[model samples]
Target: MPELPEVETFKQYFESTSLNKQIKNIKIKDTRILSIEENIFINTLRGKKFNSVTRHGKYLFVECNSFFLVMHFGMTGDLEYYRRGEEEPKYSKVLFEFTNNHILSYISTRMFGKLDITDDYKKYINKNRLGPDALTMSYEEFLMSLKRRTTNVKTALMNQRIICGIGNIYSDEILFRTQINPLTKINILQEYQLKELFTNIKEILKYGIRKKGNLATYSSKLIIPHRIEEENCPICHTPIKRYEILGRHGFFCPTCQKEN
Candidate 1:
């Protein structure tokens, strides 16, 4: 799944390559991948210029001159930018052809990505009840958001209504960095611990974005590294531990992130 950092990276790319380009056509290869009717989606975007691209949580908003195109990269979804005469890949599920010969492609191997149209983005976001994005949420706001939730700390972190853009991977990394057990009750957190957790969340997210999410790369690579067994904890020398909770894989260092 593309997390917050990955989504932000895509937003920057979209801004650079596709902004202000007038859409000449909207092509959908699979009807199941669209949230709105194919004709309506095509009609809404055909003539509008892409004003900007914004991201909230795991969703991307391509704002046109008059409306917003909602995109959710369900699991294996990504975007590609190519020029005219460049062959569109077999996986380019949806392509937005621009008047300037640039094409913005949405590719999803699993067919889970979504494309929809909306006149009001704010209303749609609110209706989805997503909390403030993890990248921009203030410390006080983050603390309050978690404190109000009664679920397990890990579950609370994953709850979109409490804080946005944190998925299984980042949640594990955050808890490991803060030295908090995944199963700990949310209300049991100490004030200082919450403060530390806030710092770690911001640090991890920001660092991930800067690295272009490259978990492991040879040179100038941007990918999110998935910590697994036998890997050393970046902060401490403890061996990384892997566990399955609620059927989701989580990683931690027992010596560093002691259960509390």
Candidate 2:
């Protein structure tokens, strides 16, 4: 799934490549991903110019003259830009052709992503009841959200209702970096531990952004504990362990994040 860092990367890509371009045409290879009627979606965006791009959590909003085109890269979504003679990606669900003949392709191999048209981004976000974005949320806000939550710390972090943008992968990384066991009860966390959690959340997320969401490309130490099964911990040489939490696998160094 495209989490905060990956979505942020896409937002940058969308801004740089697609903004200010006039939509000459739209090719809908799969209408299953469209949230609006096919004709309505096509008619609304066919000739409008892309004004800007913004992101909240994992959603990308492409501003046009009349409305915003919202995108959610569900599990295996990606965007690619190519000019004439370049091959379209294998699972491209939609294509936006600009006046200059360049194309922005929305590709989703598993067809889990979605595209929607809306007039107000804020209204849409409010209607969906999404919490503040994780990257921009303040430490105070993070702490407040944890109040009264008795769920495991990992579950709390992954809850979009409490804080948006974090997913299974990043939540695991956050807990690992903070040396918090995934099974720790949220209400049992100490004040200092909460502060440390907030700090690690910001650091790990910012680091991910700087690396363009490809931790593997940056350094083995950055992703080894999460990317490999049975791999030795980079920090302590202890074998990394995996735990099933909320139907997702979370990796951690047992010695580093031992439950108390």
Candidate 3:
């Protein structure tokens, strides 16, 4: 799934390529990837210009002067900007044709991406109940969000209601850096550890954003790069382990991130 960093990259890309371009047409190849009716979606963007692209958690909202086009890149969603004569992506479900002879294709291999139009994004956020974005949440705000969580710390961190913009991949990185086990209960940790956890959440996620979420290209101690090789932990030389949570895979070094 595309997390905060990946989605932020997408937002930046959308801003650079699609902004200020007049929407000449909106084409929908699949009905499953749209949240609104096809006609409404088409009419909303017709003759409009993209002003900005904003990201919250895993969602991207393209701000037109009159409305926002919501984009939720569900597991394998991506955007491709190419000339109109070029072949659209194989999985292009939605294509935005511009008067400039370019097209922005919305691609989702798994048919899970969503497109919708909203005049008020705050109402959309509230309706979905997403917590504050991880990048901007203050320390106090982080603690307050976690106050209601009784589950394991890993699960708490992954909870969208507590702190949006974290998923299985980043959750494992945050916990591993903090040396906290995925199964460690929230109340079992020390106050100092809790503070550290919040700190690492921001630090690690910021690192991801800086890297543009390309885990494989970089050489780091992060478990993500090693997951493909099934290698030993760089810090402790212990074998990295994988666990399934809610049908998602999380990787960690067992010796380093032992349960508290």
Candidate 4:
């Protein structure tokens, strides 16, 4: 799944390549990936120019002259910008042809992504009950949300209603960096532990954005707990462990993140 960092990358790419281009036409190879009616979706975007792009959690919002286009990259969604006469991506489900003869294609291999149009982006976010964006959330706000949670700390980190943008992948990284066991109860966390967790959340997420969410490019000093089952802990040389937590697979260094 494309998390916050990946979605932010998409947003930046969309802004750089697709903005200011007048929509000349739209081709929908599959209507099932659209949230709105096929004709309505086509009409809503056919003539507008993308003025700006923003993201919240894993959703990308593209502002047009009169409306906003929202995109969710479910699991395998991506965007490709190509010039006229260039071959479109193999999984290109929707193609946006610009008056300048360029094309922006929304590619989704799994068909789980969605595209919709809305008049008010803020209203749409509020309607969906999304929490504050993970990257910009203040430390105070994080503590407040954590104080109200009774679940495992890892689960709390992944809860979109508490703090958006973090999914399973980043949650594992955050917990690993903090040296917190994934199954550790929220109430049992010490003050310093909480502080460390908060700091690591910000740092790790920023690093992710900088690396554009490519785990392979991450430093060996920073462990990638979930990338492989047979990997060893980079710090203590202990074998990395994996187990189910909160119905999702979690990976950690058992020696480093011992359950108390």
Q: Which candidate gets the maximum TM-score versus the true structure?
A: 3
How many residue pairs clash in each candidate at the backbone level?
7, 0, 0, 0
Q: Please list the C-alpha lDDT of all candidates, in the order they appear.
A: 0.81, 0.87, 0.86, 0.87
TM-score of each: 0.91, 0.95, 0.96, 0.95
lDDT of 2 by residue, 1-260 (tens): 49999999999998889999889999999999998998989898998898988888899888898699999999899999999679988999999999998999999999999999999999998999887889999988888878889999989988888888888888878887788888999999889999999988888888888988885664556433345688887778788887787878788888988885
Task: List RMSD in Å for every model shown.
Answer: 2.7, 1.4, 1.4, 1.5
- Tell me the tens digit of each residue's lDDT in model 3 across 106-197: 99999878989999888899898999889888888888887757898878878888788998888888888899999888877889999899
Query: What is candidate 2's CA lDDT for residue 82?
Result: 95
Predicted candidate 1 versus true structure: per-residue lDDT over 101-214, tens digit per residue: 889998888997888888888787898888888988898788777765677888888888899898887788788778898888888889898888888888888877886765
Candidate 4, pairs of clashing residues: none
**TM-score of candidate 3 versus the correct structure, residues matched by position:** 0.96
- Score residue 156 of candidate 1 by CA lDDT: 85
The positional error of residue 30 in candidate 4, measured at the CA in angstroms, is 1.1
Candidate 4: tens digits of C-alpha lDDT, residues 181-246: 989999889999988988888898899999988878888877673356878888898888888877
Q: Model 4, which residues run further than 4 Å from truth? A: none
3 against 4, candidate with superior lDDT: 4
User: Arrange candidates by lDDT, highest first: which order?
Assistant: 4, 2, 3, 1
RMSD of 3: 1.4
lDDT of 3 at 247: 73
**Candidate 2 root-mean-square deviation in Å:** 1.4
Better of 3 and 4 by TM-score: 3
